[model samples]
Target: MNIQELLVTGTRLLKEKEIPTPRLDSEVLLANRLSKDRVYFLSHGDERVLPEVERSFLQDIQRRSRLEPVAYITGKKEFMGLELEVDPHVLIPRPDTEILVEAAMDMLKEKTGFVHVLDIGTGSGAIAISLTRYLPQVKVTAVDIDPHALKTAKKNADKMGVADRIQFVWSDCFQNVEGIFDAIVSNPPYIDREEMKGLDANVVEFEPVKALYGGEDGLDFYREIARQAPGHLKKGGSSSLRSGVPRPRRSEGSWKKSVLDP
Candidate 1:
């Protein structure tokens, strides 16, 4: 089949399965298989896909029909303009987390000398790597509870050429992290048990549960971070945390909360 035919067939299959963003998913999957940009389809509609390519494309469509995320299928996701590797072992980077990264950047941008950052639950190293890439004075220590997630994050750091700037550690929410930092950033799991049940199959089924569940209520990680952050943050240091709330809130106590928008 040709480019247009393949996309139409894929779209139809996804629609039948009730997958959201059927057409876009089809285009993205086909583009990934062809290693060509989506724009290529506009001018090359009649171009025939190779037999192996057609088979692989159809397989990807089947995976999507089963509700697998396109990022997981492609094994790649773009965050803060950097293409990072992704898999089932790590949570796929989302656009919402960019707000957290921007907030951290704002906190560190004004600092003069070398600035240290601690990234808790740094799955895929999206938060850690982006900071070092965008801020020349920043170096990050990224920690995660899952070793597999750490491996994936480490590979992404290497892929983005920021491995030297990030130190990957196996820790569960600062259990193994030491030293004070100028800034602490995290897009920790904030979905409570109830919300987890309501998440789409595309998310609940494909993404790692350890990266999504935030205990009985969505504020478990937030509470823990707030409690321990003061001990690790430098005097007047800031924390940029992602919460499941509607608006950002500032902490009135020892540490400041950059509780960003949901």
Candidate 2:
């Protein structure tokens, strides 16, 4: 079938399956399969898709019909304007987490000399690598409990040309980490256990559970970060916890404010 006809059928199928942004998602998946840009598909609607390419597109459509995320199928997601490889091993980077990156950049820009940053639960290395890319002089130490996630993050860092600036470590939280950092930023797992049951099957069943669950109250990781961050953060430096109100916890030593995500 021609591009236009395939897109129409795909959209209808996606909508019937209750997939959000049916038309857009269908086009993107098709464009990726064709190894062409979305605009190319739009401008060449009359062009015919080869038999093999058409079969691939149909397969993707079947997956989408099951509410699977397009990023997982394509094996990539764009973050901070950089394409990063993604899979079931790591949580797909979200736009909300971009706020964390912006907050980190602001703090890093004000400091002079060497600045060290640590990204806890550095899935896909999106947070750590993006910070390193923006702050060339800054050194980043990213830690993840999962070795598979670290492997994926390293690959993304290498692809984004910031592999040298960032260090990937396999550690559960701050157990194996050393050295002080000017800033410690993390978009750690904050979703409560009960909330897990309500999440879409594609996310709850497919995405990494370790990267999503934050324990009973959804504050386990935050509590750990608060307790250990003072030892790692440089004197007067900041550590932003991406969560709600500040939970009461003992401060380690010197760090400044610990702002919560609003």
Candidate 3:
């Protein structure tokens, strides 16, 4: 079938499954399968898709209908203008996290001299790599408990040409992280047990659980970060926690502010 016909068929299949954004999803999947931009379809509607390509596109449509994320299907997610690799091993980067990154950039820019930052659970290196990419004065130590996630983050850092500036550590929270920093940032797993149960299949089934669950109150990682941040942050330094919860209970020591994602 032609591009237009194939997209219509794909969209119908997704719509039958009650998937939101069916048309956009169909277009994205087809564009990825063809290694062409979606805009290509607008002008080349009559162009026929190869039989092999059509079959693969149909498979992707089936997966999306099953609630698989487009990012996981395409193996890439664009965050902060950077197209980063993603898989089931790491949490997919979302648009909301860009606010946290911007907050970090502002905080780092205010500090004088070379600044060191710490990124807890730097899945896909979205936060850490973004900071290094935009803020030249900062170097980041990004740690994660999952080595697989770390590997993925490392590859992203290398791809973004920020590998030299980011030190990927295999540490759960701050257990293995050393030294203090001018700032600390994290988009930790903050979905509570109950919340996890209600999540859409796109997340609950496809995304990594360790990257989503946050104990009973959805504040376990916040507690851990608060408890450990004082030891790892410089005097008057800041830490931003991007989670569903508001600010965490303050741990004693020097803290400027906590930027929480509402």
Q: What TM-score against the true fold does each predicted structure earn?
A: 0.94, 0.92, 0.93
Residue 102 error, candidate 3, Å: 0.7
Worst 10 residues of 2 by lDDT: 247-256
Instruction: Give per-residue lDDT, candidate 1, residue 34.
Output: 92
All-Cα superposition RMSD per candidate: 3.4, 3.9, 3.7
Candidate 3, residues 1-262, lDDT tens digits: the string is 9999999999999999999999999999999999998889889999999999999999999999899999999999999999999999999998889999998898789999889999999989999999999998889999999999999999999999999999999998998998999999999888877888899989999999999998887777877787677778888999887866443433222122332321
lDDT of every model, 2 decimals: 0.88, 0.85, 0.88
Better of 1 and 2 by TM-score: 1
How well is each residue in 149-221 modelled by candidate 1, as lDDT tens digits?
9999999888888899899999989799999999899988888778888999889998999899888866677
Error of 3 at 99 (Å): 0.7
Comparing 2 and 3 by lDDT, which wins?
3
- The regions of model 2 sitting more than 4 angstroms off are 244-262
Candidate 3 TM-score versus the reference: 0.93
Error of 3 at 136 (Å): 1.2
Q: Give the lowest summed-lDDT range of ten residues in model 1.
A: 253-262
Clashes of 3: 0
